[model samples]
Target: MTRRNRSGSIGFIVDDLNPMLRGWFNYFKHAYRTEYREIDGFIRRRLRAILLRHNKRKGLGITLDAHCQWTNAYFAELGLFTMHEARVLACRPR
Candidate 1:
Protein backbone atom coordinates (compact mmCIF):
# COMPACT_ATOMS: atom_id res chain seq x y z
CA MET A 1 0.00 0.00 0.00
CA THR A 2 1.02 3.54 -0.60
CA ARG A 3 2.26 5.61 2.32
CA ARG A 4 -0.80 7.82 2.03
CA ASN A 5 -3.18 4.88 2.18
CA ARG A 6 -1.36 3.19 5.05
CA SER A 7 -1.56 6.32 7.13
CA GLY A 8 -5.27 6.62 6.45
CA SER A 9 -6.31 3.20 7.77
CA ILE A 10 -5.39 1.02 10.76
CA GLY A 11 -6.16 -2.10 8.70
CA PHE A 12 -3.35 -1.26 6.36
CA ILE A 13 -0.92 -0.90 9.19
CA VAL A 14 -1.81 -4.28 10.71
CA ASP A 15 -1.72 -6.00 7.32
CA ASP A 16 1.62 -4.41 6.59
CA LEU A 17 3.00 -5.80 9.83
CA ASN A 18 1.49 -9.28 9.41
CA PRO A 19 4.75 -10.91 8.42
CA MET A 20 6.36 -9.88 11.67
CA LEU A 21 3.56 -10.80 14.05
CA ARG A 22 4.85 -14.23 14.92
CA GLY A 23 8.34 -13.10 15.70
CA TRP A 24 7.00 -10.12 17.54
CA PHE A 25 4.69 -12.29 19.61
CA ASN A 26 7.41 -14.74 20.51
CA TYR A 27 9.78 -12.01 21.45
CA PHE A 28 7.33 -10.39 23.81
CA LYS A 29 6.28 -13.66 25.40
CA HIS A 30 9.86 -14.63 26.08
CA ALA A 31 10.97 -11.26 27.31
CA TYR A 32 8.05 -10.18 29.44
CA ARG A 33 5.90 -12.99 30.77
CA THR A 34 4.20 -10.89 33.43
CA GLU A 35 3.27 -7.68 31.67
CA TYR A 36 1.26 -9.24 28.88
CA ARG A 37 -2.07 -7.59 29.53
CA GLU A 38 -0.67 -4.12 29.83
CA ILE A 39 1.35 -4.63 26.68
CA ASP A 40 -1.74 -5.77 24.84
CA GLY A 41 -3.71 -2.79 26.02
CA PHE A 42 -1.00 -0.48 24.76
CA ILE A 43 -1.21 -1.89 21.27
CA ARG A 44 -4.95 -1.36 21.20
CA ARG A 45 -4.51 2.13 22.52
CA ARG A 46 -1.81 2.84 19.98
CA LEU A 47 -4.11 1.81 17.17
CA ARG A 48 -6.72 4.15 18.54
CA ALA A 49 -4.14 6.90 18.67
CA ILE A 50 -3.41 6.29 15.02
CA LEU A 51 -7.09 6.48 14.16
CA LEU A 52 -7.40 9.65 16.15
CA ARG A 53 -4.58 11.18 14.13
CA HIS A 54 -6.32 10.29 10.89
CA ASN A 55 -9.71 11.49 12.10
CA LYS A 56 -8.31 14.87 13.01
CA ARG A 57 -8.27 15.69 9.33
CA LYS A 58 -12.06 15.65 9.38
CA GLY A 59 -12.40 17.47 12.71
CA LEU A 60 -14.06 14.41 14.23
CA GLY A 61 -12.82 13.04 17.52
CA ILE A 62 -13.29 9.58 19.02
CA THR A 63 -12.07 7.62 22.00
CA LEU A 64 -10.01 4.57 21.19
CA ASP A 65 -12.78 2.36 22.52
CA ALA A 66 -15.54 4.23 20.76
CA HIS A 67 -18.42 1.83 20.10
CA CYS A 68 -16.45 -0.92 21.84
CA GLN A 69 -14.07 -1.41 18.93
CA TRP A 70 -11.33 -2.57 21.28
CA THR A 71 -12.30 -5.89 22.81
CA ASN A 72 -11.10 -9.19 24.25
CA ALA A 73 -11.29 -10.95 20.90
CA TYR A 74 -9.66 -8.17 18.91
CA PHE A 75 -6.33 -9.95 18.40
CA ALA A 76 -7.81 -13.27 17.36
CA GLU A 77 -10.20 -11.58 14.93
CA LEU A 78 -7.19 -9.93 13.32
CA GLY A 79 -5.54 -13.36 12.73
CA LEU A 80 -3.27 -13.25 15.71
CA PHE A 81 -2.75 -16.71 17.19
CA THR A 82 -3.21 -15.83 20.84
CA MET A 83 -4.49 -13.06 23.11
CA HIS A 84 -0.86 -12.51 24.08
CA GLU A 85 -0.16 -11.60 20.48
CA ALA A 86 -1.22 -8.10 21.35
CA ARG A 87 1.34 -7.93 24.11
CA VAL A 88 4.04 -9.32 21.88
CA LEU A 89 3.25 -6.95 19.07
CA ALA A 90 3.00 -4.02 21.43
CA CYS A 91 6.48 -4.62 22.83
CA ARG A 92 8.07 -4.91 19.44
CA PRO A 93 10.33 -2.09 18.29
CA ARG A 94 8.71 0.36 15.96
Candidate 2:
Protein backbone atom coordinates (compact mmCIF):
# COMPACT_ATOMS: atom_id res chain seq x y z
CA MET A 1 0.00 0.00 0.00
CA THR A 2 1.15 3.51 -0.78
CA ARG A 3 0.92 6.15 1.91
CA ARG A 4 -0.23 9.52 0.59
CA ASN A 5 0.99 12.94 1.53
CA ARG A 6 -1.24 15.99 1.96
CA SER A 7 -1.49 16.39 -1.80
CA GLY A 8 -3.13 12.95 -2.04
CA SER A 9 -0.59 10.98 -4.02
CA ILE A 10 1.22 7.72 -3.61
CA GLY A 11 3.95 7.85 -0.98
CA PHE A 12 5.21 4.28 -0.69
CA ILE A 13 4.44 0.57 -0.69
CA VAL A 14 3.06 -0.87 2.54
CA ASP A 15 3.41 -4.58 1.71
CA ASP A 16 3.58 -7.31 -0.89
CA LEU A 17 0.48 -8.54 -2.74
CA ASN A 18 -1.82 -11.20 -1.35
CA PRO A 19 -4.59 -12.79 -3.44
CA MET A 20 -6.51 -14.14 -0.46
CA LEU A 21 -7.60 -10.64 0.60
CA ARG A 22 -9.32 -9.65 -2.64
CA GLY A 23 -12.61 -8.81 -0.95
CA TRP A 24 -10.94 -6.46 1.49
CA PHE A 25 -8.89 -4.92 -1.29
CA ASN A 26 -12.03 -4.32 -3.32
CA TYR A 27 -13.67 -2.60 -0.38
CA PHE A 28 -10.82 -0.11 -0.18
CA LYS A 29 -10.85 0.33 -3.94
CA HIS A 30 -14.48 1.38 -3.71
CA ALA A 31 -13.78 3.60 -0.72
CA TYR A 32 -10.80 5.58 -2.09
CA ARG A 33 -11.31 5.24 -5.86
CA THR A 34 -8.90 6.50 -8.58
CA GLU A 35 -8.02 9.85 -7.03
CA TYR A 36 -6.43 7.99 -4.13
CA ARG A 37 -5.77 4.60 -5.61
CA GLU A 38 -2.28 4.33 -4.20
CA ILE A 39 -3.32 5.22 -0.69
CA ASP A 40 -6.28 2.88 -0.85
CA GLY A 41 -4.15 0.06 -2.18
CA PHE A 42 -1.61 0.62 0.55
CA ILE A 43 -4.30 0.62 3.23
CA ARG A 44 -5.77 -2.59 1.86
CA ARG A 45 -2.41 -4.32 1.97
CA ARG A 46 -1.56 -2.98 5.38
CA LEU A 47 -4.91 -3.88 6.90
CA ARG A 48 -4.75 -7.36 5.41
CA ALA A 49 -1.25 -7.83 6.75
CA ILE A 50 -2.26 -6.59 10.18
CA LEU A 51 -5.30 -8.84 10.31
CA LEU A 52 -3.33 -11.84 9.17
CA ARG A 53 -0.54 -11.14 11.59
CA HIS A 54 -3.00 -10.70 14.42
CA ASN A 55 -4.71 -13.94 13.55
CA LYS A 56 -1.43 -15.82 13.46
CA ARG A 57 -0.58 -14.27 16.82
CA LYS A 58 -4.13 -14.92 18.12
CA GLY A 59 -4.56 -11.30 19.09
CA LEU A 60 -8.03 -9.91 19.74
CA GLY A 61 -9.83 -7.17 21.67
CA ILE A 62 -9.15 -4.61 19.04
CA THR A 63 -10.69 -1.14 19.32
CA LEU A 64 -11.38 1.74 16.96
CA ASP A 65 -12.42 5.39 17.15
CA ALA A 66 -16.11 6.17 17.29
CA HIS A 67 -15.73 9.31 15.24
CA CYS A 68 -18.35 8.22 12.75
CA GLN A 69 -21.21 7.09 14.90
CA TRP A 70 -23.70 6.91 12.05
CA THR A 71 -21.30 4.84 10.00
CA ASN A 72 -20.72 2.53 12.90
CA ALA A 73 -24.45 2.22 13.39
CA TYR A 74 -24.87 1.35 9.73
CA PHE A 75 -22.17 -1.28 10.00
CA ALA A 76 -23.92 -2.65 13.05
CA GLU A 77 -27.20 -2.76 11.16
CA LEU A 78 -25.38 -4.79 8.55
CA GLY A 79 -24.21 -7.11 11.34
CA LEU A 80 -20.59 -5.96 11.45
CA PHE A 81 -20.75 -4.99 15.15
CA THR A 82 -23.13 -3.84 17.81
CA MET A 83 -23.03 -0.10 18.55
CA HIS A 84 -21.93 -0.61 22.15
CA GLU A 85 -19.50 -3.30 21.12
CA ALA A 86 -17.98 -1.11 18.43
CA ARG A 87 -17.46 1.72 20.86
CA VAL A 88 -15.66 -0.57 23.27
CA LEU A 89 -13.73 -2.18 20.46
CA ALA A 90 -12.66 1.22 19.21
CA CYS A 91 -10.74 1.91 22.39
CA ARG A 92 -9.01 -1.46 22.50
CA PRO A 93 -5.30 -1.33 23.40
CA ARG A 94 -2.97 -2.08 20.61
Estimate the Cα RMSD of every predicted model relative to the unseen true structure.
7.4, 16.1
Question: Residues 1-94, candidate 1, lDDT per residue (tens digit)?
Answer: 1232247456667666555655656666557667656655665555555655666533344454542765546644665334365565766899
Worst 10 residues of 1 by lDDT: 1-10
Cα distance off (Å), candidate 1, residue 73 = 4.3
Give the Cα-based TM-score of candidate 1 against the true structure: 0.53
In angstroms, the error of model 1 at 90 is 18
TM-score of each: 0.53, 0.25
- Top-scoring candidate (lDDT): 1
Candidate 2 Cα errors over 4 Å, as ranges: 1-35, 57-94
Regions of model 1 farther than 4 Å from truth = 1-6, 57-76, 80-94
Q: Please report how far candidate 1 places residue 34 from its true position, in Å.
A: 1.3
